[model samples]
Target: MSEEEHQHPTSHYVKIWAILLVLLAVSVTGPMLEIQWVTLLTAFGIAGVKAYMVAVKFMHIDQTPRFVTYLVTTTLVFMLLFFAGTAPDVMKDHGTNWEKPAWIAAEAAYAAGEVSHEPEHH
Candidate 1:
């Protein structure tokens, strides 16, 4: 084996272990935090950081070429944008604008053969 291959240090693994420990501690005691939004944000942020660390160090993707990294980054970016853009439509104030159309009931009646047409004579 060449010296260059052997030069791949083990400190990355140690860093990964340390990050995993912190993530585990947070997961175990996360419910005890009372800061609400701040707590949630911090937890998510830490989780993202830990995931990135694991992907780069343990998965050895950090050694991958730049194009592959850009492809992964672009995919994540587009996914986040799609989620952000569509979430509001799902959680909006759709009061009277949400009512069903009268044509729907008419269609049901028509399908059931319940329609009636009468002519008045004077």
Candidate 2:
């Protein structure tokens, strides 16, 4: 029908916006703590929450037909598969008939403490 027919009160969307903002702040600040597990958790966890909120409240995806939900789920699954299939190749330092000498040099320098690209923990 119309926006008013499907939408919640203004305060409801505003509250969701405020929650998303707070989550954004948490995700941005979380990595600064430099704990690997905490960083991963906060990054992915807050991101998933924010994505769901935007989908349900702003996009009104939940109001759509059940088939739409299945479509979205399938799309996300394919995306995950695509990423998983490519990530190992992308992360490799060398590949068939190709090498990254400059990156290797940079890594060597960082390891030797000659070039300080990585932030020192103090």
Candidate 3:
């Protein structure tokens, strides 16, 4: 193979550096925001953008066959869907229903023999 076959010119390096700068900016600004939801969304969005840049441009994903690329992309999409779909539920406040009133509930349970108050040795 000739040198031409292996050559990726300086422009490719420049593009990578440009993307790196954007990624760096995002990394720096992401944590400085005070609004919780906006900050969370911004950080995740920046991460997704940076990941796409790295996967496509640096990883040479465009050189792969269409089916292989589609398969990988689809798998990642499903993985993101799984995570995103669960974040709110996992972060939600399920409220006092899941929590005991401590005094009344514990005492009632103990009186009813529904619970044992004996201390277990660690």
Candidate 4:
């Protein structure tokens, strides 16, 4: 097959770029509407669309073997799983055996309109 057979016209790329720019504009403006669901929709949903476009069009991942896509997807799942497994521990302020007194104090102070002290880590 010739290179021309695999090549798209410059106009095609320009059109794709224009659409991506429009999506970018929408995503950027989404947060300013001050709606939580709408903000998340544009931030994550439109970003996902932009990522798919870049991967399929620019990277030509569509032409790759199916397993490459599977690998990427599996990796993403594992990353999410790791975050899920660790996030609770990371976010907790206290437990039965241990506590975060400094952080808790600092947060309470800040909330009550007092000067906040930095938490000490050991």
Best by lDDT: 2
Model 1, 1-122: lDDT tens per residue? 56576345788578779879978688556746757675776678678878788777777677777788888789889999999998766544343468344656766776786774322321
Candidate 1 residue pairs in clash (backbone atoms < 3 Å): none
Kindly list the per-residue Cα lDDT of model 4 for residues 1-122, writing each as its tens digit: 56676777889888989999999999999988979999999999999999989888877666567888888779879999999998887778887688899878877878996764434421
TM-score ranking from best candidate downward = 2, 4, 1, 3
* lDDT-best of 2 and 3: 2
In candidate 3, what are the lDDT values of residues 68-114, reduced to their tens digit?
78988899999999999987656543444653356667678789988
Per-residue error (Å), model 1, residue 24: 2.3
CA lDDT of every candidate: 0.71, 0.87, 0.73, 0.85
Per-model TM-score versus the true fold: 0.60, 0.81, 0.53, 0.70
List the candidate 1 regions with Cα displacement exceeding 4 Å: 1-11, 93-122
Kindly give the stretch of ten consecutive residues in candidate 2 with the minimal lDDT sum: 113-122
Decide which is better by lDDT, 2 or 4: 2
Candidate 4 residue spans exceeding 4 A from truth: 1-6, 95-106, 113-122
Best TM-score goes to which candidate?
2
| Candidate 2 structure, TM-score to reference | 0.81
Provide the clashing-pair count of each candidate structure.
0, 0, 0, 0
State the weakest 10-residue window (summed lDDT) of model 4. Answer: 113-122
